[model samples]
Target: MRRRLERHLPRALERLAHCIDQVRMWQPGQFNYLNSSQYCLYLYFLSNTIWREERGDEAVGAATRLFLLNKALNGIDLFYEIEMPEVFFIGHSVGIVLAKATYGNYLVLYQNCTVGKNHGVAPVLGDGVILYPNSAIIGRCRIGDNTTVSQGTGVINRDTPGDCMVFAGTAGALVLKPATHSLVADFFRV
Candidate 1:
């Protein structure tokens, strides 16, 4: 696991660097201190997680401590910063909160979805996960691959297994079925 994570670290760092460059270009001088502050916070989060997985024991205490410090210093009302795999945002607006511990790939989070910490628990999302507008997933939970969390759905303390369809209702239910590719492709046809 450590080896796999180590291999991906360079790519993650590159992405972070790219984001910083973009921010620098746009703001010029406004975000100098703010950018460094956020960068340090993100680095602290990433390093501790990596260290815990690799060395163990030594890295366990740093993440929580740093997170608390970040919140106190920044005066931001929201807590939780999402660390995502290599992916670009198609569109993003303000007021987005993503938890540090959540793990996922190819995630697309539209504006206003709060992926937050629920009693120090973080969500584990699978690949190709899309959280539509106003969707909130909190606590220790797993949302499966290829799943679309519809708008205004709040999920807590649950697991949506792989290849399943989740819908809201009085008695909310999930159906496990293979995703059909051609059906999805039809939606893109001009």
Candidate 2:
């Protein structure tokens, strides 16, 4: 496990730098321990891919998940085999899907968000995707980069373009629109 982490350290470092950049930290190293969320997310992916086939390592992975994330159990508890890039954030870690055969990068997930298979199909998410609280992306959908899935919205069997936002309409339907604000810049404010 240490060897695997060592091998992936540079990638993690780079990703951590990106996270620090996102937060606009003056010192990158200090931002690493600013909170435990970043480390937990890193361990979440690591526990799934690197230690998936190992028993002892998986045990450590289970402990990590249990200690950090609330929803995951039994060794990472990933819904599917996912490949995610770095500098992503997962809020509350409840019901957020780790891709049921999908890929993601720079993804941000809030509480109760799900991104997995609706039937037998999975969605492919691009970079800088944000799944707000209580949102979902399921089944054969394509989510482009810098897209925001707003609160209380769910996407199924649809394709969303880049630099857009998905919000719940008056009648509880999903509506798409051009991104008016900088997603990366105004994310925390929203």
Candidate 3:
């Protein structure tokens, strides 16, 4: 596992530092990263430290223990093809999987959330995006920066503009609301 991680050693370390800085925990060689959320961030770095996408399956299997420790991450299988910038936080890991080759930055995913693909089409998320619990993004959608996918909403084959929040209506349709003045405004300080 360490050998595979060495492929992107610098980026992995940088992500780890970012996670430590954000989570505010400084314990080298120790599993004391505050909460399961913090550990999930660490596991993401490990998941992305592969040379090839197809090879990720083996790497993630090796990383299963870390995910199990967190318990929320029901086995984090981050496809190597999916590239992401530094992730800030993960509320819980239950049923969370970046199922295909995707891209994003500063991501926040809660429990039971999936940023997956439909018919081999993976979505591309922008910076500071949050996928709340029970929300699943599918197909070739583009989620703009600072967008929050509200709980229980499923997005498929759509383009969500930047700085917006998506909510589900009674008919299970999405409602795009402006991001300003919403809970996403002050979601994080780090």
All predictions: root-mean-square deviation over Cα? 8.9, 4.9, 4.4
Whichever of 1 and 3 has more lDDT, that candidate is: 3
* Pairs with backbone N, CA or C atoms under 3 Å apart (clashes), candidate 1: 82-98
Model 2, global lDDT: 0.63
Residue 65 shift from truth in candidate 1, angstroms: 18
Pull out the clashing pairs in model 2: none
> Candidate 2: TM-score?
0.69
Task: Please report, as a residue range, the 10-residue window in candidate 3 with the lowest summed lDDT.
Answer: 22-31
27-120, model 2: which lDDT tens digit per residue? 4455444354555555555444443434475555653543345234322234313455545665555455555555565677777777778767
In model 3, the runs with Cα more than 4 Å from the true position are 1-11, 23-34, 50-74, 182-190
Collision count of model 2:
0
Alpha-carbon shift of residue 162 in model 1 (angstroms): 2.4
Residue 5 in model 2: lDDT: 59
Instruction: Score residue 140 of candidate 1 by CA lDDT.
Output: 80
Candidate 2 minimal-lDDT segment of 10 residues: 72-81
Q: Best candidate per lDDT, number?
A: 3
